[model samples]
Target: MKYKVCGRLGKNLKAGWLALVLSVLPAFVVADEPPEDPAHAHDPANVWFIGRGGQLYDSWMATTMAEKPWGNHPAYPAIGNKRGYPTWRCKECHGWDYKGKDGAYRYGAHRTDIKGVRGVLGMEPAEIQKIIMNETHAFTEDQLPHSAVEMLSYFLSFEQIDMDKYIDRRTKKALGDFDEGAHAYQSVCALCHGYDGKKINFASQKYPSYVGSVCARNPWQALHKIRYGQPGTGMVALSNVDLGIVVDILSYCQTLPEE
Candidate 1:
């Protein structure tokens, strides 16, 4: 039976069977080994880390689980206080567009006359880290872990997008298809923000800040959040999706009630 299985005459059967066995051996060995995880699963080279870094930049205090800096920032006197953790937010001074005084916050309640980090683009990540820890910035390693700082640096260095391309800063309108955006919003955003995007009151009722308010008032910030998600929240980042979808969602959100 073994000789017949080898498909050879009696004398050559052993050699033929040996050749067959040798050829098939590697297959069994490969099958015994566990399969590797998907390439997207926790890959160090994945751009998702950059998105997380963007989230950290949006609200380091929230991302790092660190206490907000006590009192106002040294430069806060010129900017006025709005109270709460927002005062300590990096975007509070830098502006969501990263244009700081040169951009959206140039003359708003968030104005601080501070230069944006736009100049810092393409800078060495290490240099950005040093600036973050510098006395002027005064971010302590204790407050923000090295990893978190590195992530923030990565975001500033690589993930800062040009809002001018996707939004009309003057009109505060998203440059996307409204119907497409509405569909995207109803699919996922409506779960927390509601069909009208007013289910969640990110700000006080008197102030009446909602998704629409954010989209209309600070489109840059809204775009950043939509791309990277809010820190320390269940809000999912849409970084992996086509950015046009994000712009579309922003357009739909703009149609919601702002006040």
Candidate 2:
């Protein structure tokens, strides 16, 4: 009887020790989690780095909540439509397609006629950082912290996708299964975008551009937003999911309301 009691006590102690170890492990394991503050949430995960980097590349001001610069960037050409805050964005000059003059933004309100950053795709991050910090680019430390720049460099180096492969630039259609995409969207996206995806009107009540309009007009931009999230918004980046799934979501979004 005493031996059985001791055996039971041994099992209890073992279980108790296991529980204690399990409780303490998460704190150590999750130490690398991004901070609660949005500005400081530079995640270390490879996919998260890509997401944050993409957001920063999209709009550093929106990503870091940094104050807008006073005037047009010194490097910004007089021919460029974007001035001041907008010009500061990496994409303003480079194009969402990452091809700059060679890609989608070659001629539009967003055009700068500048060469895109696609050349830097396989380049070293340090070299890219130097280019961003140099006099030609001239991004100041106050406007963008080194950490933020690191994210940008990481993104520019690794995050760009050949959007043309997945989207038909002419027809502006996604090369994905609408039926499979519907399931993914209804399950994952409907919470914010709604069943019809008219929950948020991006343009305004008059024009009333919703997910469909944006996706149809610019599937490349929409895919980027889907994978990295919208800046200054609570939109969650779908980085951890499969690329196929992301494209599928884009296909479904294309079917939503435009106006």
Q: Highest TM-score: give the candidate number.
A: 2
- Candidate 2 achieves a global lDDT of 0.81
Q: What are the RMSDs of all candidates, in order?
A: 14.4, 13.2
Total colliding residue pairs, candidate 1: 0
Model 2: how far residue 124 lies from native, Å: 1.2
Model 1 weakest 10-residue run by lDDT: 32-41
Tens digits of lDDT, candidate 1, 16-40: 7899999999877654222332324
- lDDT, candidates in the order shown: 0.79, 0.81
Per-prediction TM-score, please? 0.77, 0.80
What's model 1's overall lDDT? 0.79
